[model samples]
Target: MARAQRPGSPPPGGLSVQDQAPGDRRRDSWKDSWGPARARLTDLAEDYARLLASQDPAAAEATGLPSRTLLPDVGPEALAERNRVERRLHQLVRAVETPRSLTGNHGAKDDDARDSTPGDGDPWGRAPLAVRVLRAHLLERLGTSIDLIESADQGAELNILTSPFQGVRRRLITLPTDLPGSTSSVQDWADLVDRYRAAPRALTGIRDSLAVSAAQGVLPPRGQVEAVARQTDDLARILASQARGDLSGGGHAAPGGALGRDLQVAANDAAQAVSDLGRYLRGELAPLTPVREGVGPSRHACWVRRMLGTSIDTAEVYQWARQELVDVVAAQDALAAEVLGTGSRAGDLDAHLRADPSTGMSPEDFPRWAQGVADEAWDAVVGRLLDVPDGLGRPTVLLDTPGGGVHYEEPEPSRSLSGRVLRSFAVGDETVWPWAERTTVLHESVPGHHTHSGAQSLDPSLTLWQRYLGKVPGCNEGWALYAERLAIETGLLSKPADRFGWLAARRWRIVRVLVDLGVHSWLPVPAEIAALPGAGGGTQWDRPTVEAALRAHTVLGEGFLQFEVDKQLGWPAQGLAYMLGERVWLAGRERAQHRAEEVRKKLDLRAFHNRGIGLGSVGLDLLIRELG
Candidate 1:
């Protein structure tokens, strides 16, 4: 985690005041400069954070927020209260006016920047960059929450990932052990048992909400219901096994102890509740749910804005993604030709790569190997490609719970822990593919999520709400995708096999954009894409057709492919964020570079990266306005 110091620069811990940009220097005096308006915004943000924590326990735990509830209350009354609080917060934010002195307008004739704001007459439109960023974030996030509630999407949400069912299980499984402020004391163990005991009531609330949504003619897709039911069954088995002291692996208290016996009893009860929910999902909900997986254009549009923090023309973006996929596949084909001594399709190249002995590692060695890759990437990028703070140390690489997929988790808000890059593998799966994972290591660790998120965690300029709750998936995922491409452009993917792996992963994201749009927005599959081998005889996008397309274009296994498709279908507009976010990142960087050239000054990529990452998580529009 050690960072090398740059010549004539401040030490690695953080940037000195003199080294910061004029705007950043202004931000350093944020508390003193903004005065009353800043205080009001801070208060409002804190209020919203508390409200959010109450509504989503999983999010609360993830961000290290203190929560009285172990699980989210998803009943009708809770949903209504959540909506009311969001609306009230939104109104309060809208009413807060910024002081004109700190606005930094300087009477500039920047129409592009001006147009990005709410309007000329709006108080927030004339606010400082930081104030505007906060205001915009709150407005969009609150607006999205209100919209989801009013549209009934919030009530009817049953997804393969991120739904209440999964949230409850994930929280319980992690419990007091992994959370912030947890000492793993007897009280902590008792609290864990209490949470386990509360599982039925929380799950029952979820079940009731789903049933109510169904009665009101708002039901999730049958595919999602089935997928979640299967997941519930899996969770039931996991919990049941834990109750029997089979899977604890010394992570829990001694099985023979009183606390352990209490936990076992509670877990068994929780497992029975989960099993009941699964049965209800299969026997009751699935019969009434629609067979079509898409949430249709309206809901999809709302999710697009919510997830991306910007609006997109679905047809245009879909067409653009189609061409991007073509380009990526062509690049992969060329790489395959050079590496394998013959040109091959993407799927063929992936198969060959998977079959290569040198590409595989045993499961036991995977974490250590991944850590090495992450460490190497950290050493390669710091001070050269990015100005990483010394406090933002290298993330730990660990194996995650099965089926969680590879992802990066930020450090706790307390800063007592470093970030972690979790590599999820299927249960009993032996071989780990490292060739295709090198770029992913870069994407999840150095110069990617950990770098981006760790920077946010260490930034004193950011408010607690901004650091913890201000995530825009498009900005975050886009930056990670950009980081992956950055590694490729910098020759970090040194081996041909690794390069091909990067290309394949890139192609997979492109395919996601296509399928996400095609399914959710009901867009037609392009003629050329339909003509591809194994695309099946379908003019329209369906689960099978989408899966087939993924199979042909990427190297994901059948289980992962099914999971990915179900996830995309269940979580509309989410799959498109990675590439869409990357688009903004690249364009924003290019525009910054061009502006620097116009001013006859060389653009520093390191500084540009630092500034962008320092912005925490804002929308693409806000990102462009701030960076530009």
Candidate 2:
């Protein structure tokens, strides 16, 4: 049997070495132009990337790094080591002088702008755009990481989504067996077996950290603990079933063979480990966790910085969200009236659309329909709206596992694998809503994550850290939300039903701001919002009250709505990223437009988009400055 080719090997019929030489030379020239300070930053970024890859195996696999077989060691010793490495990296970053060409006469005067917060330092003192963005990115990112670790926030992070328990199992289940080849080799199976065998140790490390957190009174809420425990139990069952299936005939390895048996035994062991974790969480940890879901003000602020890469005044943001929610609901009501030719209630409009045979699709047709939408979006945007690199091809659309939710997975940094838009549906979810899904496809594929992430991966000017690790949710999710609105502006959502879908999506995000802030920061629910049916009469926000609010304002299915609520409760401040990020994007664009008009020039939308995305993922604060 032929051995699997390494990742990053040219795909069949892809560009040959000669064909790629010109682009390669161009990239080299770009790198050669960097000054010593920039060069030092790039070197540090590479070092950090390697360190992260060694510590985070799931991340390594996601980014096509070499260490895909290992799992993260989240024990106290490992956490301390990581903190030390981050501190040293931070020191080196601070010591590197700004290039004189980049830092004009401003002389790095510290300013207390919203972009610059305490301990984050300032990155906006007359430096060239590139220098300022890079410096700010490193400062904000490293600062946030160090803060989370030091504050014990890292140890207490258990959630429905993005927690270590879920991440380990998800990564294992989704591990790419056919990497660098069309079919798995025996070696590939062996590698997977190795990961399964290592699962117990990795999970033990996580449990140790969580135990420490519990002792320190830094535990996640009881709800999150319970949810994760249930999820772990489900995952254990899936793993066990998977093992038996593989041993019988479901996998590439021969039945009753040594490799097959090894896989079965390893997978069973991993399942048992997961089962043990579930029991521990439910029996020992849940009772100790706080009943109230909120993380309170101080921890909420830390999470805001971690998720958005900027600090926000929670009260101010909450007030803004209240008014924004009002405005969005008004707009949504008008759209509903236009779409249904009746009342302005969103539920009625959604019901009408869902009941319409023309608007519904069978589950079998969902992927193809979604794919067409993605392809059409590509054709509509490229060249006309934005300058897409020839190498950053269209993303593939597929149905993911049940309950996975809709998301975009970035391509392997090497570009050997294309990005994917995974659309998940709950079991028995047979009907697909095109009107709603069209905006989603546009957000996750064409002008959203795939476009942003693919461009970053393909850019030779980016450091490895920027390409693989520089994920600011504010910049990333904000751009996607902006893309949704852009689609409406550009006529992609021209149909009345589709346009209403956009409004529904917009309203959903706006509602998220209120719900996230209300629950996490303990903001009092506004009077008007509290009056809505199902929204319980209380100043405080709770799961039932928030669920009622989501029901009234958004068109999501029950399962997804519950999932979203749980996600917000468990992962504080993350749901705020969409609306808050969009706020910055819109403000940035308007500022650019105003400046262009002042110069008596029309702003070129294509260039504006390409240039902004070309900077790769940075904090919203850095994003606005860089765009200007």
TM-score list, all predictions: 0.86, 0.86
Residue-level lDDT tens digits of model 2 in 1-628: 0111222456335766567666554433332333566667778887888778877886575555666337776767777888999999999988887433432223233221123222443433443345446777888898898998888878888998887777687656754442434466667677778889999988888888899878888888888999999998888987898678543333444335887788888889999999999988999999898887688888888899888888898889888888887887777678788766667676677777888786688767878998898888888887777866556788989877687378888776354778888888888887888888899899999888878876777666667788778788888999999998878787888998898788788888888888888988888988877988888688988888888888878766787889888988888888889999988889889988997999899998887887788777888777877676
**Highest lDDT: which candidate?**
1
The Cα local distance difference test for each model comes to 0.78, 0.77
All candidates: CA RMSD (Å): 5.2, 7.3
Q: Which tens-of-lDDT digit does each residue in 276-336 have in candidate 1? A: 9999999999999878768788878888888988889998898799889879878887877
Poorest stretch of ten by lDDT in candidate 1: 1-10
Candidate 2 global TM-score: 0.86
**Residue 562 error, candidate 1, Å:** 2.2
